[model samples]
Target chain A: MTRLTFPPALHAEWIKIRTLRPQIGALAAVPLATVAFSALAGLGAGDDDILFSAFFGVNFGQIAAIAFGTTAVSAEFHTGALRLSLAAVPRRGSWFAAKLTAIGLPVLAVGLVTGLTALAAGAMTVGPQARDATPAEWVRGTAGCAVYLTLMALLAAGLTTVLRSGVGALSILVPFLLLVSFVLGDVNGNAADFLPDRAGQVVLHSSWDGTLGPWTGLAVSALWTAAAVAAGLWRVRVRDA
Target chain B: MTSIDVHDLTKEYGPRRAVDRITFRVPPGRVTGFLGPNGAGKSTTLRLLLGLDRPTSGTATLAGRPYVSLARPLRHVGALLDAQAAHSSRTGRDHLLVLAASNRIPVRRVDEVLEETGLTPAARRRVRTYSLGMRQRLGIAAALLGDPGVVLLDEPANGLDPEGIVWIRGLLRRLAAEGRTVLVSSHLMNETASFADHLVVLGRGRVLADTALRDFIDARVHPGVRIRTTDPAALENALTRQGHDAVRHPDGHWTVRHARVDDIGPLVSAAGVPLLELSAEEGTLEQAYLALTAVDAEFAARQHEEVRP
Candidate 1:
């Protein structure tokens, strides 16, 4: 038998990501929705905080990022795709690793582009109000946006793999990101700051009063993503396709 | 040489055993037909052999190693467990391309398999638009993508048309002739009868018979004598007197059970019965299969009755 290499498996997974329509839609919507909403948020800004307004689109754009990651992994659960995939690359860990790479890289790329776009759109719309932000802050926030979104997407991908359904992952994630991050977190005080979405969102803020700083907040979210990924890998290894 | 070896492989889901502890070997350069009724564990066994599902105990191996141990699995074993396993959004060609790319198989072989499977015209169309037959063809094309040495197909002819079925039959024969091992499972006895060299029949997750196709059929189907006598009444009376149960047919022919043509000829002549014509009818694979499964059906019926209120 020919030796199983990583390149071919990675290429095959990359093909799956680009071929499906929903995945493309989710990926495309990341920048569009993020920039669009940031522009709107910039227009309604009251000059209290400028940088946060510029990255405001991330609030809405992250849904698409998570959707992109979730849909990518969830497609395999349907149509006996996992069986075909595992049959080709018999080692479960290698296939999952390739799949995660396929998922993580694209979402990170799109997330970075969306962050910069949202930043530019926010600066243009909320003109002069955004002038208080330093270039270093802009760079940190932009890079942080990309990393945070990529982490969130990986988190969704991991959950979807465990559930083996795109809908199942979306159902749990969408409501948590929307309701918990926006609504419940407001009333829950310091405890809500550590939730995956809220902790990650600290990077988008220009000034913060939370116990966790921007990078630390991202680390918290990273921990959540790592746990989800570890659980997903364990499930794939033990469960039959 | 043995290409596929399954030893005491069993799989259980909760209280139900999907595959019982059973063993068989498929030699190279031949087609082994896995015959069973629906839910008889044929697909489950294939899944276990391919490592898609872990066995409860024992092992299934390819050449001397487990399937998972193969470096490039698709290069050694090609399996088509479900035709609908292809994502509907992807085109037929894309599906095979993904599989080919996974194993580092050249892209040219993808087109070749499409051409061979008569799927060149619909290769670019999304899989959702294709008919069941087209999907089946696509699955077979994927299985042949790597041009692997061992092919395991579960109900390969499930949705094919008559011509498609004939094409698959010829393709399987050609693959086996190329010294590749082919194990195809199907509930349709007549379909497998035309091409299978070996037969492994299963019932209720257990193997009922494992032998060569010819031997399996011969062992189960008893050859009977067909005779046409001038005096039907005298023939019956003489056969009764000679302790032979000659069953009369609606077409004026009599079938002599458990007796050969030679035995019938001498007995009829000695009994003074004029025999106009006599011939021997060979047993068919379908008859043999039905005879083997009739007991299974009866047992199922009794169990059903036992559960009724």
Candidate 2:
């Protein structure tokens, strides 16, 4: 006689994300791309910050994370999944919250694993420079890397919900992460650091020149995620499924 | 006690009003056919009832409550809006599982529904690889998973094979027999006539007819005298001379509209035509549907955009 709650909805979303082969591959790429790219970046490393070099693979992983988030939301838009999902749950807000949580948790877990692997690989490549980083610094970078990637994935999920197209979200996000963040940084100066990718990535840098500190920078990225998520929720409420 | 009640429901998409101000009730222990043509707003009405789309004006509710207000919606209403609504990459079993999980339904019910819908063999296959018929079965499986009191299915037989069609016919019948309120929408006239006793006929986003199927047919169509004679031309001439409109079939049968057996029996004797077959034919549902829609078309033509229902 109980009402449907958040837990079952979350469980359902979890099952949906895992059952699909492509979604599983998208998630796997989060860690694979991060660790792999970090290893590749290590070979070219001569004299770089010990912590940031270990997390460089995170740059590549962000694209895959965006893909995972975008695909998770976009798949529901196609072929009438939204109709079916709404029919089953009916409460749009509760279902959406569950969907975002389902998207964030796995990416965060995989991102942490990727961070640890990247650090080990960096330690091998940098040789003696790895000892220069304090245990506290290593812990901060690994944890920050995971949280940043999870936030980016959630940001992408929120945008995908609004756009209702994975390609639409990825096309804007992927290119911005690859180039626009840097371009805006040079052109717009300190203001450009507020971009989601740049603001979130600040935690990885051993020394940052931007006005925002590590926590404040992540908070700026979170503000962008919150705005996208709010818009997406409004769209789902006002528009017909 | 549970019934689907729609009150003055209307849906407008820009300038086009897909579902006009229409209202009807689908009560328990009966199969109500929501019959309409392609653009008759059958799908649109069902979407609004299921809370997939908001109505421009009016209310659609189950047991006097809106669909979205139901805490456990799947426990009260099972719906199949589109068979292709499930993601292409998920296995058929997983799609039903997602629905069951969302509703707090037991996992074993998923297996039972799959078995009932004849999708057990293909349950593990991804939806992309399944045929349209298989997808339909999978959709039915999802609908039956919750074992809800009311069932709403739109175009449930769209892609079904003959055997699948027969299977669904029995399934709907059995569901109604169990005293569940079942509403099935379809544009196929004869297919609906076979299973439904109560009918809600929609034409141009309006309720053209809402009554027992027999009453709808009897009201819209007139009975005709079916006559077969050795000399078909002579029989036709006598009926025409008497000012009766007689339609002739390729099989040499003559159907005299608005005429009785007594009207034709005396004439056939006077015409000296050797009669092969003579009987009063009840007006068919097909004839009634055509007559009803044809009238609707004429009104649409006369009024253009101003025609209501």
Candidate 3:
């Protein structure tokens, strides 16, 4: 028997992602929504920590990124698509790894584009205030923004695999991001800092009071994503497709 | 050549055993029809065989290897469990292209399968716009994309029109003729009877009969002759005298069993009886299936009553 390679499997998964208009729409919406919302937030900036204001659009943009990842993985559950997928690639672990790679690369690309546009949008609206973001800070924030968004998307993708429904994953994630993280007062200390959205958003901030720095916060979020992905993998291997 | 070997395979759901200890071998180079009534574990067995579902006990293997263990399984075995198992928004060509790309098959193979399944004309259209027959064709196209040696399709004829049915029959026969192992399952006995050389009939998750199609039809479906004569009484007497148990129907026709029409015709002529109409009635595939399942159902009902009381 001929051994199946990972590249071709990843190619197949990418084809599945690009062929659907909804998935593409979800991906395109990320940058547009992020930049537009951040530009609006930039107009009302109070001069305190203007760097955070520039990338404020990420709060809204992350939703689209999450949707993109969730839909890409969850679409397989609908209409018995996963069965056909598994039939072609019988090694469940490899197929899932390929799936995650497919979701990660596209979101990473789009997230970088979204971060840069959000930065430019902020610079346009806040004028001199945005200039406070030094070149080093600018580079770190943009790179951090891309990584943060990619991690969020992957986290959603993992959750979707567990729930087996795009809508179900979105219901839990969207509300948690919008209501639980934002609306609820930051109950100080390590607990609030560890929430997936808040923990990752530390990178977007120029300075922070919490113990975890930008990279450490992103690492915490990556750990969360890893746990979710591990759970999803375990579910896929054990559950009947 | 590839063959399917199943042994003592069992699957249980809660307290219910969906598949019992069933054993059968499907040889290569023949269309083996997996025949069973609805809820008779045919789908479960197929899932178990494909490694989609783990068996409770025993084993089902293709060419001496479990399906999951086979590297590049699409190159070795192609299976279609559901015809509609595809994204509705993707075009038929794109769907096949994705499967082709997964196996590292050439982009050209996608078009070839589309042409083979007669879906090339509508390949670009989204699958949501397709009819059920068209979807079945697309599923078959995906199944054949790898040009695998073993093909297992569950109810590939579900929503097909007459022309599509004939097309599938020819396709299955041709696939088997290529020395490939073909296992096609369906509850439609006559459709399977037309092309299948071997049959593995299942009832209540058990192998009720596993034999050649001809032998199955011949053994279970008793052949009889329907005879109508100007003088029914004389014809009956002549047949009865010749040790042929001929029974007279209320409609004045006689049914003669265990006697060929040639022997009866000669016997009746010698008895000076004018034969108005004589027709040979052989057992049909449907009849044999019905007869087999009837007993199975009866036994199940009896067991249910005994347990409840």
Best by TM-score: 3
In model 3, how large is the Cα lDDT of residue A105?
A: 90
Give the range where candidate 2 chain A is weakest over 10 consecutive residues by summed lDDT: A181-190
Indicate whether candidate 1 or candidate 3 has the larger DockQ.
3
Residue B202 lDDT (model 2)? 94
DockQ of predicted model 1? 0.66
Ranking by DockQ: 3, 2, 1
Candidate 2 stretches greater than 4 Å from native: A1-4, A182-189, B230-252, B256-275, B305-309
User: DockQ for model 3?
Assistant: 0.72
Ranking by TM-score: 3, 1, 2
Q: Write the residue-wise lDDT of candidate 1 on B129-244 in tens digits.
A: 99999999998998988888999998999899999999999999999999999999998888999989999999988888999999988888878899998999888888888788
Show the colliding residue pairs in model 3: none
Candidate 2 residue lDDT tens string, A1-241: 3655688889999999989888889888988888888878877886467777878889899988899999999989997889898888788998898999999999999889877877788788878888888877787788888889999999999999898888899988998899886566434346788988888887887777778777888999999999999988988888899
How many pairs collide in each candidate, listed in order? 0, 0, 0
Give fnat (model 2). 0.84
Ranking of all candidate structures by their lDDT, best first: 1, 3, 2
